[model samples]
Target: MVTTPLAGPTDRPAPGRRRPVPRRRPSARARRRSAPLTLLTGLVLVYTLLPLVWLVINATKTQDGLFRSRGLGLDRDFALFDNIARTFTYSDGAYTRWLLNTLLYVVVGAGGATLLAALAGYGLAKFDFPGRRAVFAVVLGAVAVPGTALAVPTFLMFSRLGLTNTPWAIIVPSLVSPFGLYLMWTFARDAVPAEMLESARVDGAGELRTFFSVALPLLAPGTVTVLLFNVVATWNNYFLPLIMLKDPDWYPLTLGLDAWNKQAATAGGEAVFNLVITGSLLTIIPLIAVFLLLQRYWQSGLAAGSVKE
Candidate 1:
């Protein structure tokens, strides 16, 4: 007999399949507790961004407007473009020279530092050698020492070798980043696999080839992290350059800007605070661009082995 089945409750879910769980709304007490945390987070955001806001606002103002205009508000005269032009053309293009110098330092110095740190760190992690623990201890000690403490000694050493007032003064010291080495060592220990290296060696690949082909790719995230740290440290380095360089032509942006800032204070100096402000703004743009460009690496996966059940 072809009998039609009766309809069941429309609201009931089918057997063996559960109904979707309903979400709970936060209680009033929970919301009330979260309110203070939300407020505090907002306050912290504002506090952190305040200085950057001030810099942006002031960078747009002309010298006269800088002194005369309201701090937080815009000036009637929009001279940001004019200021940028002047900033480049000022003092027979000293700013341009300083900019080039900074780029050179970062490219050669920071770049070298990152590369050495990676190779050394990877080696320290993967290689079995005598005195490896001692090397680790030394690196940790070096990391603990503040760079400022080394400035005087570095100056004295460079002075003896007649390397002061040269690019080497900046580049040489930047090449030895203990913190970068340590960071890479820690990262490599987990990010790269010993089994992979063994496989590569069994496949008749040379050490260098194995590193470049297998290990280096795995080390990219850690490498980028160390690179950024070195770049920032080398770029913003004030004390080392201050002590090492006396030539304005050799000066990095940090020292160059400081020189501009001191104009008003100097006995026979002109007040070019506007240029200082504008140049300061220019100095940080590359750093911001770098951070934005490389931020994607921070989220990507580390190295992994064969999938296991």
Candidate 2:
């Protein structure tokens, strides 16, 4: 039997043909780099959420439990429903009226404000005319002027015009949001394309028609963001409503809740304490529901805004 000679060492595979080594795991320094940010986020979340937790716990307690028990502990009685019932029926169901008023104002005022702001922003961003930069600069300066600074002057002007103590006083002023305009401007600048507008024009579409047909859908994210901002601002507004409305019949929830809180400080009004707490908790439900419902739009809007030239 003839045996073939085995390949010699010279014919063997080169030793350098080893597999590539895996990458090293992240070192302790990388983890350390992320720790401070994590801690800061946790601190901020706690700071923002502590009051909500307190409200949730205390809202479930009865009038007696509110004063007698530890703030963090559950009460012997779950009086939330009872408190809500009294709150709705108290003083001929005034709290319900206040809630309705708030809803109306938010819908009309915030809704209109969003539409107008979107129109203004789209125009400012997409169209060019004389004094555009000056107009934008003025709007920026107006945003810098605090709402409080304008309150007194607005009150005086409304008083002179005999428009004070009316819904118009609150609704009209809310319609002009310089910040909303700026936000919409920034969003539209990045979201809407010039070529699309030109293409629509080339197809013989009028400006308004093009805006409604081609631009509005693209502007969905910006519009929703502006709408949510205006709604929250209008819903939680206190100072302006306080200055504008004197009659309890017209009071919004924020103002009405404050009044009830003050009343609870008195002797016979102590029972109102539970009502106030229950009402406060109930008021937040709509806001939470609205956020949950619109969060998808809000996220899309943010994504659109993140696109930069």
Candidate 3:
């Protein structure tokens, strides 16, 4: 108690001592460093958005207005609805057929691809089997090989099997996504715990039952990611369908739109230009909607897998 009483005012900060200054706003050097990054980000935004902006603006114009008006802005006469109507009704409603075909591809091809990727990835992550590493190496190599490179060989193989020009051609090629496999493999490795798998096994749950009931739930975000990627890929596929499909009836939206674009470029085919622009606009809307709707799952999956316990 006596020692405590002996403690002096000097033990406290001197009355004249300057309190620490609020961290001076980030140093000028840091601000200078950030300036280039800010500029680069702005440039990237403009670069990415410019095409979309042009597409939207052109989509609103009449066929005459499309060529007559400035390339980057609205025309005096807006005919967005008229263009959309013509897009759907043109050529015996072929656009509708293309749209339906695209949907079919997305649902069957992408959906199947996602399921297979999830199963394969989870299996690769959680199980041990002969040739597992070889399978993984082949997948990695496949990822490195551009789809364009395989297009010729795949077309030849399908041609021999007589699968070309059918929905099976597109669906078969889309069924295997090496990137998706790798993505799900990494995600499953982190998201599903060995302890949980062991517990499920100990409880007499079969592997398939445990996977579907327990592991699949935890893999939702990863599944969504794979599904969305495959959906977009299948929906927008051009070169594959362009080569495989000889019949216009079998054409997906991407190929059909290119056909329309080609037609528009020819003499006396100018009227179809507006339809092409409008159809292109319509094509991207579903994709945009999909991203907006599923962004939450995508973000959550990415965040969840970013850290490991």
Candidate 4:
């Protein structure tokens, strides 16, 4: 008994059981190291949300409330519905016309741009031909050039061709997306392997048939990315439409909204600031919807070739 106390049943560990391991806590030093990064991320999040918050808060107020309330503060009137009604009914339902015009541009201009980009990009990537390097260099140079720099020249060219002030003025130019073409070219290079195209060809599939049947599915992600980019660019296009179109009926929402903003400067023009804010909010909703709908595809597209043997 003096040598060792008898082991009690309670003191014995359960048979075949192991001790539970405690979760390792981060060291104080590790937390300190992450603090700056966390703080920076929070600040960036706040900065991004601030303007949107301001837009939402201000969009709810009436014309008089806009001038009366603080930038981010809401008014009690809740004129959002009234503002929307007035915005559409203003000037022979101009806002509705602008909305339709924007949809048309997005559908035709962006859609055409994506199609052309896909065809050209797929061709450039898969085909072997002369002057390919030259074409690549030209595309790169075009991408480097700012669209605004070309707006005046494009206007002049379209004017001479009698294409200005028409839908073609906007649509034709939107179809030639240098960045989109380049994006597709690169994406097609990696996404659709030459082996698959070769296999398709061996199966007696024609080039167009092979593209539509074999390669197009693989190119979905890239196509969607290019489509989104072109959609945003064409939908928000202002300077081009401004110089290209003079008719109010043809105006896209961007130009139309700007007109509403500047209307007060025109003689006998009453200010519709509340409507502008509400319309601005409405204008962005579709873009947000598009982004939300396509974001997963874009992400998958990005991760397409990330892992390889």
Question: What TM-score do all the candidates reach, one by one?
Answer: 0.91, 0.86, 0.87, 0.88
Rate residue 187 of model 1 by lDDT. Answer: 88
Using TM-score as the measure, what is the rank order of every candidate, best first?
1, 4, 3, 2
**Can you write out model 4's per-residue Cα lDDT over 1-309, one digit (the tens) per residue?**
469788899888799998689999999998899989999999999999888888888888999999888888878789878888998999889999999999999999999999999999999998989999999999999999999999999999999999988989999989899999999999888888777788779999999999998777888889999999999998889989999999998999999999999999999998998889899999989999999999877644543563454
Whole-model lDDT, model 4 = 0.90
lDDT of each: 0.92, 0.88, 0.90, 0.90
Model 3, which residues run further than 4 Å from truth?
A: 1-25, 265-270, 299-309
Measured over all alpha carbons after superposition, the RMSD of each candidate to the real structure, in angstroms, is 3.8, 5.9, 4.9, 5.4
Off by over 4 Å in 1: 1-26, 305-309
Residues 60-113, model 2: lDDT tens digits: 888889988998888899987788788899889999999999998899899999
Candidate 3 per-residue lDDT, tens place, 173-285, comes to 99989999999999999888887778889999999999997788889899999999999999989999999999999899999988988985688875478888899999999
For model 3, name the residue pairs that clash: none
Candidate 1 on 5-33: residue-level lDDT in tens? Answer: 77779967888999789999999998899
Cα misplacement distance, residue 195 of candidate 2 (Å): 0.9
Weakest ten-residue segment in model 2 by summed lDDT: 299-308
- Give lDDT: candidate 2, residue 13: 70
